[model samples]
Target: MIIDITCRTDRFNLSAVGPHFINDCCFGEDFSRWLVGALRRTGVDASVIGMEDFGWSNQATLDGTTYLVCVAGNSDALADNPDRGEWHVMLERKRSLMQRLTGEGKTSATDPLVRRIARVLMEAGLVEVGVEA
Candidate 1:
């Protein structure tokens, strides 16, 4: 499932005129790392896997289920409003070969980590766009 969001960069210590990433990544990269850290702090096993063209790739395991996460979008801070930015967050279950062939293990908003991540973003003050928040 995908969740679109708009947020204030100050919440994540991001600045338009300053460094945008933590470790040689793209605009939204730091935020992705921040999320993984947040999840870890909450006792969730999450980690940043790598960078993606759009943003960053991450992986998280919960209850023996692995989930692939991508937080991507136009994270460019507006020139007139550097604190504001947007993101497209996606999460999917990594299906086994048999499950993939059988068309099972699909993820949705109701999934545990999906709902948890959504709540995390909301609690962090990001506003969900074009969907129920």
Candidate 2:
């Protein structure tokens, strides 16, 4: 399963004093940091991998299943106006080399927690959210 999210940058405020403080910890830096923090808060083992061309990446493991979260935004647009556009986010299962070679874990199983993660953002006032297989 792959969770896809598209939301405005202003919708997720990082400042606690901001009006959108309800989402202060929801999305940031393309959502890698936020996802890692959110997952950990939920008792899931998650860590940020590193930065990417348009955003950042992270890995989370739950019940022996690993997931890779990739987040990105329009650099040019953000550079011109920080809170002007939407950010794109995706969460997909990660498989080890053995699993890939053996054609296992090719598709992600429906994970309730993953849905919870998506729900959090949706309820936080995201512009759009979808789950893909």
Candidate 3:
């Protein structure tokens, strides 16, 4: 299976650090590194696909994978795998449950995690960043 991990690539998509998941991470830089490492651990090949004003997409190429996993500014993980693999299932499941449940009992979370991840990717020398807000 394959998954896409997207995040807000916007250099000015910032808001108050609410008491939600959005407040936890905000496109810092550590998140992205974690992502790359996570995928690496799972034997997945992930590539950054640049960003728009406030969005970016990641390509997770797993074992013979050819699908997508898209995350957004305030979005979750999107895994598309024709042949669901065990590794993919576990990896995705962990992320889904952690992210969704972590922000429980709260309004919409403009998930800073994704953005923070983008920042991390930039610093890790994996993704080249133009500007940050």
lDDT of each: 0.65, 0.62, 0.35
The C-alpha RMSD in Å for every predicted model, in order, reads 4.0, 7.3, 16.7
Question: What stretches of model 1 exceed 4 Å from their correct place?
Answer: 1-25, 75-77, 129-133
TM-score of every model versus the real structure: 0.75, 0.65, 0.32
- Positional deviation of residue 109's Cα in model 1 after best superposition, in angstroms: 1.4
Q: How many residue pairs clash (N, CA or C atoms closer than 3 angstroms) in each of the candidate models, in the order given?
A: 0, 0, 14
**Candidate 3 lDDT tens digits, 1-133:** 2223333333322232324333332322223334656665545666554332323334555444222333333422324322111111101212345646676322111233333334554554542332222
Q: Is candidate 1 or candidate 2 better by lDDT?
A: 1
The top-ranked prediction according to lDDT is 1
Could you tell which candidate, 2 or 3, scores higher by TM-score?
Answer: 2
Q: Between which residue pairs do clashes occur in model 2?
A: none
Instruction: Tell me how candidate 1 scores on lDDT.
Output: 0.65
Q: In model 3, how large is the Cα lDDT of residue 2?
A: 23
